[model samples]
Target: MDEFERHGIAVVEGRDAAARALRSPELTSDPGLGSPSVLLRDGDGHARVRGVLREIIATLEPFPDAVRADVETVVDALGTSFDLVRDFARPVAGLVTAAVLGVPLDDVFLDHLEATTANLDVFGGTDRQGQASAFRLSVQLSRAPAEPGSGLAALRAAHAAGRLDDDELAINPVVLAHAAYENSLNFLASAGLSLASGVARTSARDLAAEICPARYVLRFGSEGPVAISLTDGLPFGLGRHACPGSGVALAEAEIALRALADVLSGGCRVEDVRWKTHPVFRGLASARVLVSV
Candidate 1:
């Protein structure tokens, strides 16, 4: 059995297991947004979904200009490449979470999270004590606020009001970072692949609309499980604990896709596209492309 299954982490496969996981009370009994350890418990239940989304959206805006600009810059850099896993996804995610959580981010913070998240595959075993160090570094770096009057400050306030505990509060940034970055990365990668495959493009506003119609995007690639793996089992994760930020994640991805498509529409084409050898997640670590305006 896979290590995930051996550890009782629930290795869901097949479309049915995927579907059941989405609605499984075990997954949603607690929210996955605030911390990793807490995810072991039941999630906060599904009624909290809308509130979580709203909170994330509201938190992301009104970020310090520097942070927002950093996000755009990183995303723009990622656009030149055909792959989206680490190059595009992690950086974009860091920006999104920093923007949303009012966590001030710089190249340092971005680099740290990118490294930590990327090394997750290496963390489980005794082989890498560095993984543990990186994890601690993420926790520490994620604590700082992006701006004086950002939503994270308010979240802290609310937490002090007894609304959130120390574990939850500490975990908020980590979760936020993971949520915003990873999903954004995946969405961007998928969008890029879609453009590359000619299945979709950036310039066609109408086509973008059709490709990203929430439900449709959620199940868009059932036909090619190997290429895109839209089987509904673990693509977006499962149960209520699945990605609450999916809607916004989709929008971020769509925006990135549109940008890429727009650039390509202007005569740019990706070249030397590459892929990371990751199984749980699929993405291109890097690629060289020609961007002609």
Candidate 2:
């Protein structure tokens, strides 16, 4: 069953319909939460905040060599038996996220980032713990010092330059961090699982299209809230709010997946595979990959 039916949110399915809906000016990402996060708002504020985010994303557009080194090091250290999520995907995503924001993010931080996925979900607005996770991360980033020339620092500079107001400053750092972390975390783990399953080989781009981690995004239309499906070749979305950081994400994937391929070059067996139940983000909960000795 379509989960949106239970929530009373209409769904725009099919490629052409979804694409048209995404391009429709009548629909909006805003849910009247009056939230300051770029993902939840529309109009001028959305553009302003999104512009700042685009600039930050541009810094890592081509991605840095360090990203390749980071994923390589993590994959190289994998033991004969490892949980793909815990040992491989998590660290690769976490490390790249840290680089994206120029902050030190440990397991605890990554855990909270994962939890905050609910906060962004139109279906998950009622999740108290998810909201709490988002709040906690917002506070954490606000107080933590940022590395110069990093995303966090870039956001602060934008705030100082009057590009972002108080509310925008207060929440956007968390928004940016979550946006950077969650998709990568989900996509990498899901993609890693696909490769480990010995499925026919495909490029990271094709894998992403097939496994579109972000299944849907919310938009309020005259008919009320609706979920626009992304399964239709629009993995990164489209129109006004299309993902501004896709290039960086793909670069991250190419490096990480290449390293993963090398790690799995030899024969391997998989067992105890689990999958995340989250409606929006598609990923494995856990999977044990035992490389043949």
Task: State which candidate has the highest TM-score.
Answer: 2
**Candidate 2: residue 64 Cα off by (Å):** 0.6
Across 114-186, the per-residue lDDT of candidate 1 in tens digits comes to: 4544323421445254355356654674455435556566656656676566665655555456556654554
What lDDT does the true structure give each of the candidates? 0.49, 0.85
TM-scores vs. true structure, each candidate: 0.66, 0.96
Residue 272's C-alpha lDDT in candidate 2? 95
List runs of model 1 lying over 4 Å from the truth.
Answer: 1-11, 26-38, 43-54, 58-91, 117-149, 202-230
Error of 2 at 152 (Å): 1.1
With candidate 2 superimposed using the best TM-score fit, by how many Å does residue 163's alpha carbon deviate from the native? 0.7
